[model samples]
Target: MARIYTPAQFGGYAAIVSCAAVIASVSSLRLDSAIPVVPADDVSAISRLALILPVIVAPLALGAVALLPEEINQLKSSFADGAWLAIAIVAIMQGVTAVTNSLCTRRGDFVLAAFVKVVQPAAFAGIAWLLVRDLSVALATSWIVALLVGTRAFRGLGLVSGWRDSIDACRRAWRYPVFFAPVSLLDTLTQALPLLAIVSIFGTAGGGNYSQVQRLIGAPLMLVGLAVGQVFLKHAGDLIRASTPLTPLFLRVFRNLVILACLTVVVIVFVGDWALAVFLGHGWRTDTMFLILVILPVVFRTIVSPMSSVFLLYGRIGLVALWQVSYFVVTALAVFLGRSGASLDYLLATLVCSEFMMYLTYFLLAYFLVRRVDRYQLGLK
Candidate 1:
């Protein structure tokens, strides 16, 4: 898009997408998180709840987006025509996609999940190129991902029917909306924070640059981490069912992620500028220090975000939510400190340190949660 649209336009697209994403996080009422923990026998009910809630709740989430200040819709108006409508549609579509993606992963359909991860983005880019003057990145990507994944996300979900199943589904997983909804909401907001912060503090051009890095670098790594997480969530259930020790499994996953994390940090620190120059071209600023400060936290995030599911697996949703709230506050504090008569690099630096610590706090919590669950399951407690 750099070759076709200005940085400001790309940033506008990102802003709208990020706004919708926060709503999308809870559009399913976070029922999808129940998939991994719910018994295989009750999988149908859980899937039903996960899928159906989005339909009922998506409009509400979109309504929340629709209430966003009118100023948001004014961005790049000629290119981003119908920006508010785009947010509403993307919010609903992405919510459905998130639910279905989890459903597919529950079925061990990682291939399709991985395929959608890659292909949906590719499709969006292609669609955007064709619709360049229209600036369709946000809308195009949401449509493509929803269409590609919803087909299989609904597989085997037709087993039950009628209002009976719907009510039964609600009865079965009422804990999700009550418990994990806030966690998902806080998490998506935290994930979207830096981009929104950049846009707000540093302006649209900075947001554009940051979103590109995320799309090209941070998101792919996170998706791979999430793919691994899906497998972890699935297998974590099996180990629990069989009364197996989770510590060994947890450690093995942690070690592997550390290796991947190290490799990514090294690549970004050494050749980040060169890579950005090649991929995004010289038109965009690709400062080395800025990249390090902004991206370092993402490297640590890749290691922990996927594996943090241990808390949920152990029925510690409340604990995880508490941690997420703390994480968001400290991160926002970092941004606030950085913005108060401090340079952008400083904002990113303090943000990095604070977030790195928060991620460590989460990783340690997950580690101990596994040990506790293992002891209880194996009768060591």
Candidate 2:
């Protein structure tokens, strides 16, 4: 076997990222969420922020890349050089992480996978520091690094064979994600709109406060969700690829999520307030509000994220898009109506209600997809 990536290597990387994130978080002074407010404040900053959306859309907008039939090969050549250069310059740490995780998954090296998970936060911490100074660079760099690293690591672990293999794997992976991009964009808009709305209706401080609440609480929830999704993706991908039954697997994942949701509810009910108070101080410790507005959506979203892997396995991209569209519409309308009251409580309540409804829709859709897969696998249809 090629030299294994020791846990220490993973731990070291994680530490660096963690440190960076800590610095970034502090530097942000809880202003990361205030980003959405930029366009509303200064026209120049708004233009800068607007420019980023296209950049964000570029990589995933491969369909546009494909449309240049006469220049297909040229586009590929150009994109190859540009993408690699961008990733190298901006996302080296994240790239390392992605590659490592892919390798671990392919090798069935759960130990390495576990290690990779821990290291990512350390990298994030590092990226976080950069973010404090420049939000755009930090955001772009973090994602590029993470994706490239995952891509490269998959090759190292023999999940993929080489650069071309890695590209193909990403292409396949991107298929479903890309299909859902429109609705995904909508969801992004809805999720991010609150901060924007607050800034428009209120100001930077208002946007910043709500944004901070989302970030502080959202971070841990996302981390746990990340670990869960990664583990599930690896396992489920292997099973589906092997042609093993997936209904049982789907049900199992659902059960675990339900358990997690229950536990989350308990925590939110009890220690959530104390934890928030300790971490964010009294002004930010609206855990009750956060629990209602943020935590539930996070939990619901986490549950769907893993299960979405199954849809990818089945190539049900359109269905996934449909679900996200539903979610976006609901969330947007809720936010819009909530803003009318001009109170934080009203906004928080709207967010919570929208997410709860969205989660129900996600669950139902997920159930339908799984059932369809079962019939297809059984030759019942």
Candidate 3:
């Protein structure tokens, strides 16, 4: 991607991706989340809701984006001329793929789930590697086509057999639409803010640089975290439904994540620049400063993000929502203060500090919730 497309082009690609992610977060109304928690008989209804909701919701998300002309333009720049619809299509695809992914996760089909994650990026990079021209448009269309990535997970499932059941499922899972969707959306927004802020402050090229920084130093480890999150959500959710203690499971995850984080930081600190130069270019390589503030928060986020499902399992939506609101406010304020000072270092520093602190608090809160559940479970035993 780096060799074929310039930083500016890559930034546009990243921007479009971030926008699609925001739309996808709420597109299924987060009904995919309920698949593991709900009764077996009800899964089909939820699957139907997952398929239909994205159609209804993705347009609304795109329409709302249309109201923000600049945001629309950022997305537009990523596609070929006369291909503006690619944005909405890709967003809908992302939402649909998310639900299918949830389906795969629910069934312990981790191999397929992992394969689905690889196909898009591999396809995008392969296409870009073949044709350097119209790089952004090619990438956009690749993602648009990737909506089919997880369709295998839907084969035995009934997505449209009973419309009435879908409605009933929607009614039953009203809390997900009302509460979980917004929290999930807020989480996506939080993840995307730094790139957006950098682009706003710097330019698309800077956004590209920041995006690659994440791809290089953060993404691989975070991919591991995400894969772990799927397993954690499944198993921890099982613990909840079975009325089993979860603190031990939570702590084991926490400990392993910490060790993995340390290993990631060590590797990145030692050979990060080499990997950056290899993947992007020597010109885009980082220095010591990047090793400290930038990498710290990346590792911090890895530890906290996966375990967050524990909160949802325990019905602690209020606390999760509060943490999300606080994270956005604090991070946005950092953006505001740094933009005012006109110092990228200050912005990055404040951003990293704020995120590290926020993630730590999130981990502690999740731990406390699980421990409380542990006490109750022991008393029952």
Please name the candidate that would achieve the greatest TM-score relative to the true structure: 3
TM, every model: 0.91, 0.62, 0.93
Q: Which stretches of candidate 1 lie over 4 Å from their true place?
A: 68-80, 376-381
How accurate locally is residue 358 in candidate 2, as Cα lDDT from 0 to 100? 78
Candidate 1 residues 28-73, lDDT tens each?
7887777757777666676676666665676776676556665773
lDDT string for model 3 (335-377, tens) is 7887776656677888888888898889889888888888887
lDDT of 2 by residue, 123-143 (tens): 555664634433334444555
lDDT of model number 3: 0.78
Off by over 4 Å in 2: 1-117, 123-180, 379-381
Candidates sorted on lDDT, descending:
3, 1, 2
Alpha carbon deviation, residue 288, candidate 2 (Å): 2.3
Q: Candidate 3 at residue 237, lDDT?
A: 85
Backbone clash count for every predicted candidate, in the order shown: 0, 21, 0
RMSD list, candidates in order:
2.7, 14.4, 2.4
> Looking at model 2, which ten-residue stretch has the lowest summed lDDT?
28-37
